[model samples]
Target: MRIVVAHNRYREAQPSGENTIVDAEMAQLTAAGVEVLPFIRSSDEIPTMPTTAKALLPISPIYAPRAQQELSRLLTEHRPDVLHLHNPYPLLSPWVVRTAHRHGVPVVQTVHNYRQVCSSGLYFRDGMICQDCRGRALGVPAIVHRCYRGSRAQSALMATTLAVHRGTWKSVDRFIALTTAVADHLRDYGIPDERIVVKPNAVPDPGPPAPLGDGFLFMGRLTPEKGLDLLLEAWRRHPVGALGPLRVAGDGELRPMVEAAAAERPDVSYLGQLDRAGVRAAIEASAVVLATSTWHDVLPTVIIEALASGRPVLGTALGGIPYLVGAGTPREPAGTGPASVASAVRGDGAATLPVGVVAGEAGWVVSPDPAALAAALPVARTGAAALAPAARARYERTFHPDVVTKQLIDIYADAARTAPRH
Candidate 1:
């Protein structure tokens, strides 16, 4: 099937998993014998836009005429069977979906973040998960709290964009949610059950399971939301004991704190930001991977990568972490619906929500609080060997490229059938 993949890449200054996922998926499709055409824009290009255009960026999320025209041109020329969208923000707006409809091409969108319901796209504010804007009429609460990049004006513009384009988002042929929890949350927002498809992100298989490594690994942005502080506090309280030191990779605002913790404790080591190879090596060198995010993160690539590397993940029981770690039960964790799901809805949802199988069955899932995580540390260290196989098994069943690509092909075929028969 011929498809057009459209994405607005986040800036590289703070590398994004969305950017990596889009690039990887395109490569996967090509290798799977599908014809893929990329129509991409980057946040890095914002400064190069004309001065007049730069001045209007605050409202660009609502509509970008240039993006519309360019996409229209591509649609007319390529006549793609489907237009697959990832992220369309400041430059490429939701209008692209409308534009695809105008050209008789059906569109499929992937929900990489909570952008439609939250101005910050993270559902996070003040160092906590904040879902105040979910299902709200105008997302006024986001603006009131300066949720987007800590700017009220910017948040207001994003709120306006979300409010105005709600219909455009719902009109897409399909919404590919990164997890079942995310899919359920979309339903709570009134998106139709059939419209949302649960599809987890995949990483290339890093080969057969390697021998269990010593210690654990933490990688990704060193930010509050990522649970950098929470991880350190938990480690300081738990202190690894004798299973080797905790190796940290990645850099951000919390570097000084990480460095300080390293200096103060012999069990913590800050390796700074590692390149892709370094990250892969670290995963193979660790007994478990830490995804200690305190926010409702869509899904951290690290968790999947760790599983692919045959290492179990010990993540907080929040957002997609529980789902990735394969913890909890499948009966739907409590409070995942509109009445209960919140930016700070942590422990309450662990029961009724989808937390998958517990650590022994798959991987570990603990609360984001230091005390909770500290308590689970020993369990992870002790069961690392028994959990390694389950982790890799999960990777093969769900995230293997061949597996995900087959799902993608089916979705593309379904979307193609929905295209206007003009």
Candidate 2:
């Protein structure tokens, strides 16, 4: 099948998991012998444009007509069976859905974030999960609070774009949600339950379990939403000398803080801005992965990567992490059972536990507080080995490229066949 995968990448200085996932999916399709065409736009390229163009960036609701024209032309030329969209904010806009419909290509969108419901994209503000605008008019409270980057105008523009294109809902045939919790959340916002499918992010097999290291590892952008401060606080309170060293990989706005904290704490190590290979090595070497996020995140790639490497995770019990850690069952302890076992397997093995835990399991979820994280640290350290096998088994079954590729292909094919003809 001929597929056109279009994505507007976030800026590279702060990379997004969706960008990685889209690139991986495209590569997977190509390897499977599918004709894959990628249409990519980068945030880095936008800054180089003329001032007038830059000034108009916030008016995506108005400029969407031009974007639709361009997309329609591309579709007319490529005639892709399906148009898979990842992120279309700021520049491309939701009008791309209409363009795909005009060109008789089925549109399949992945709700990578909550941009449609929350103008800030993340339901986070002032270091807390802010859902004040949920189920309300997009611009109502978000604009009042200047949610997006603390700019009222930008937040208003995003809210308007979502409001204006709310009618474009008919243009999309399917919405691929990273977790069922997210799908249900979208449903609460009026997106049809039947139109959304739960397809968690997957990671490549990272071979067999390596010897677990001594230190705890944290990977991801060093940002406030990621709960880096909380991680640091937890480290400070960690039963002095009871915890191993803490290594932070990746860079962002909070780098200086991370560096300072590392300097202050002898056990903390800041490995600033590691490449993909370096991140993989870090995951393999770490005894446990820390996902101390303050917001309600969709599926985080780092969590999946940790599982694929046979590492246990200590995650915040907020947003999609709980869903990924496993459905809440009293039978198993947090971060134990089938998911960990499944992710530990050498190759293509099914997790023995329920699907929810296998993909969602293999992690400990604590309250988003530093005290809570500190309280959970000992548990994470002690449970790491017990959860490794199950975590690995989950990775083999759900995240293996060979397995996830087929699921994506099926979704694309179904969208193509079911989408209305122009």
Candidate 3:
């Protein structure tokens, strides 16, 4: 099968799960004997773009004429069976959908975030989940709050881009949602159930399960939304060495916060930003992986990585975490903790259901609250060892590259068949 995999990559200085996933997917497809024609743009080029190119950046999101012309020529020449789109922002633009359609090529897009409406793609602002523009015709709230890169002008441009591309997005042949939460978001955005497919991102399996390690590991971009602060608060709530040792990794806006936390307590150790080898090593040395995103993170790849490594996860009940953790089963069969509580209360005074037995194999899920998360840490610590096999099994069945890639190939074939033949 011939497929055009197009994406706009984030800057290299920052770690982007979307970028990593795109690369992995391309490699996986190639290994599976599919011919992948990559059409990629990087944000790092913005700084080095020619003067004229820089001037056109403001309107690129709405329509990148040069990108369209190039893609048009490519489509006309290659005529790939399907054009699978990933991130299309300031460089590629959603015009690729129109371009592919014009060439009679089917277009399949992977929904990476909430960028269809929210300017920042996070649906979060000012340490709170914000979706003020969900059902609106235009994302005026995004412009007002400067949700895109913290620039009012940029946010306005992004909002305009979202407004202009509503039809462009709807016209897509198929939507690959990385998580059920993302699929639900697409439904809420007016996409029909038939057009949307739930396909979670996959990571390379880290071979066989390693021996369970000590303490816990929270690895990702150390940002506020990623739940670094909440993890620290929960860690601090417990006495030192109570829940083994907490090792923090990754670099972001909250590096100082992580450093301070590590300094304040001997149990908390910040490992700084790690390379792939270091990450693997860290995961091998940890028991439970913490994916505590405070926002609606569509699919934080870290959670999948943990599963691949045979490590259980203790993640926030928000976004894709609960879904990733398989929260329906009771860890205790009839208990939330040792006492088997029927329900747990959140910091917001709302009652939430328990996730499996205390050591449900896939770890636990709790509210994003410090208190709720703090209370569950020890339970997870106690249960991490037993959860290894199930965690690895979940990865193989759901997120292993072989499984996800075949599903994607099928989606591509379906999209090609259903599309208007050239």
TM-score of each: 0.91, 0.90, 0.93
Best by lDDT: 3
Backbone clashes in each candidate structure, one number apiece?
11, 26, 8
Which candidate order results from sorting by lDDT in descending order? 3, 1, 2
lDDT to native, each model: 0.82, 0.77, 0.86
Please name the candidate that would achieve the greatest TM-score relative to the true structure: 3
In candidate 3, residue 187 scores what lDDT? 96
**lDDT by residue (tens digit), candidate 3, 238-343:** 8998898899999999999989988989988999889899999999999999988989888889889999999999987678777787763233333344234355
lDDT string for model 2 (174-220, tens) is 99988877887778868877688888877667789897877689989
As a TM-score, model 1 comes out at: 0.91
Flag the better candidate by TM-score, 2 or 3. 3
Global lDDT for candidate 1? 0.82
State, as a TM-score between 0 and 1, how close model 3 is to the true structure: 0.93
Residue-level lDDT of model 1, residues 118-170, one tens digit each, is 88888778898888887688999998998888898888888899999988887
lDDT of 2: 0.77
